[model samples]
Target: MTAAEHLLAAKSFAELRGSYSGALFIIASGPSTKAFPLQRYADYPMLALNGSICCLAEAGIAPLFYLCDDSSFVRNRLPLLLQALAHAQHLALSPRVVGSLLAQEPQALDGRSAYRFERVNRLPEGGEAMSDRRFARQARKDPDFECDFSWFRQKPNRIGFSRNLDKGYFSSRTIPYAGIQLAYHLGFSRVFLVGVDLDSSLGRFYEQGEQAVKSRLDGDYEDYILPCFRLMAERVINPGFQVYNLSANSRLPAEVVPKIDLDQLDALLAAS
Candidate 1:
């Protein structure tokens, strides 16, 4: 299908609101994911991110929802992205990713159920004049920068977790945050984050050496990623929308997202 046709076929986020009321898993590309038992959740809905779909393919299962927040991956690794999209039951792509796919392979999303979401660009709340100037310059230069600056114009210039995805989602330098927001929009009660190890030294489980994708996690962790999770913990994650981390060794503090082993996860699921 052509990109225009794909757009015509794409479903709106509003259609997905409150569609699911059960537990779901978000598979990320952390090195620890190599050990995750994906087959155990074959019957359950799983959301795969970036190259993490390789793990799902290895388990001979397809992801219920697949998201690629990075357009660079679609440009640099089109084959892998296409491979994942072929097996994914649903798609959640940024506009830039869709544009890249349109340029690379207009027919890629044929007959697929997809939802497109915009990213919220957050400028520092305080009078960080230098940072604001830098961001303005970068936004002016980058053609694919699809940031919703609506929050920036507000009085306090606040940034927090997006409970309603149709408005837009905050980009925390990690695609997992998008997945979590998508889960919330889909009405999931319990969300499991698998392979969310924030350590950049280990690299991804699916790629190594020259084959690995470049990472900005080390630089973005403290300033962007951690603070975003803390905001989510404070504002969004409640009994109704509980989020659990399966990656025990993740760099994220336990207070931000409670960590649990598979046994604990199973018990929680059983209890629910």
Candidate 2:
């Protein structure tokens, strides 16, 4: 029930990478996400990250790809995800969401549709874990600190952490760099980012018609949503792989990705 407990359960990625191969895009639910024709890319080995499942459904997009874990804001959107899951081959979600999902819908996962559940251990301080003492201590001394998490507790069904991930950066806990971490762990040589526009100029990232609940964490966690991507670029970019931002409007760090116009994505895919 603790945020750390949920996040730790979400850390695994090996099982998710087992079958899929090819470029996997980490899709977010930013407004720009609606500008692109996502349905066309359904067959292009995609991965919908968190709240993206809703935007994809709105765009009439089907998930040949799976969904990656991100936040509890999206985690609460489980019913919509269940509907989206029927269209995807696999579903990799944060352990918090997974626990909630299992509790809410005993039979939410249907193995018949080529779908298997992959668990994600959330980066502490990124989810509802901000209430955690460890995270609180870090933020207390560092005024500019961002990211939120809950208390830590051992949990089952979490993705095991790798040595590279356990570096004592801020604290014993971690943050929301999962989009990049999970993407790389999935063996994506090239990444196409959609809707990952973390800036508010694009629009509220978590829109469930419940603006009040979203507003509470949005202000404090801005550091987690966008900065983590920059952090991810520093940590995950490698010789064999690179990331590109494919949004109509984006403000990701230059190191994160080379921004691409939607038209370019369409034309490039059409040509291919």
Candidate 3:
């Protein structure tokens, strides 16, 4: 599908409010997300990433939706995710990663009611009618013995999720792009990020499940994550809608308020 078609297919505020009307809960899959008192949030609709999905599942907190690119982290925790599918409202994913989730199907969600399994993009030409089993079977024939989908990258901004070559403003900035898209669709004036710890220890997302991944690019934090986020913050965040990082490990400077917590946000929301 085209970019417009992809964006149009995304859930909109009207449909969401018609169903779940409340704060647009942004659940980052960072290890620290496991720290939140999730039971306190049983009533809110949440969008969780891969590891956070695992943590959320273990905590008995059913998220409204799960989001993740085709990173290895996502692949490592498939069983946990497939388990949550039985309860989650939807599983929002990029196109490239669909293979991983599809391959695990048949068993991943057997006997469970059908939940929304949305692929961010349309299936490629000739990929139509390709059921989960058929796709997996084809992968079995690959000579390279590699059929994983963790290499899936988000499509360029406003260009849809399948066009791999077009780089819009937010193509490289995964977090903010998704946040903005979700905020617009959820009708939120502010997007608060909980557990957005970009610190990569061991070049992964957890330390014994509590650690962070490290980067060798000496200032990769600045060179990579920051520039992309800054660009997205400038181009995407609307005047009425703002994005704030609300994690204990958030490295965003004070210029970005609630950079540490929701104390101030709670007060503001309460007053409003």
RMSD values for the candidates in order, in angstroms, are 6.9, 8.8, 11.1
Model 3, CA-based lDDT: 0.49
TM-score winner between 1 and 2, please give it.
1
What ranking emerges by TM-score with the best candidate at the front? 1, 3, 2
Q: Which stretches of candidate 2 lie over 4 Å from their true place?
A: 1-21, 55-61, 68-76, 110-177, 201-222, 225-227, 263-272
The numbered model that scores best in lDDT is 1
Which stretches in model 1 have alpha-carbon errors above 4 Å? Answer: 1-5, 121-158
* lDDT, each prediction: 0.78, 0.51, 0.49
TM-score leader: 1
Give lDDT tens digits, candidate 2, residues 93-149.
545555566566655653423222222222445445433455444543442232333
Candidate 3 wrong stretches, greater than 4 Å? 1-22, 107-177, 202-224, 256-260
Residue lDDT tens for model 1, 86-133: 788888887778878888777777677788766645322332333433
Candidate 3 residue lDDT tens string, 1-272: 33233333443333443233335567765556666666665665667755566666666777766665554544666655665565566655554444456554534433333322233323543446444344334433543111222123311122221111111112333443454455445456656676676655423333364344333333544554555455445544556656666676666554643474556657654654
Worst 10 residues of 3 by lDDT: 160-169
- State each candidate's clash count: 0, 13, 11
Candidate 3 lDDT for residue 39: 68
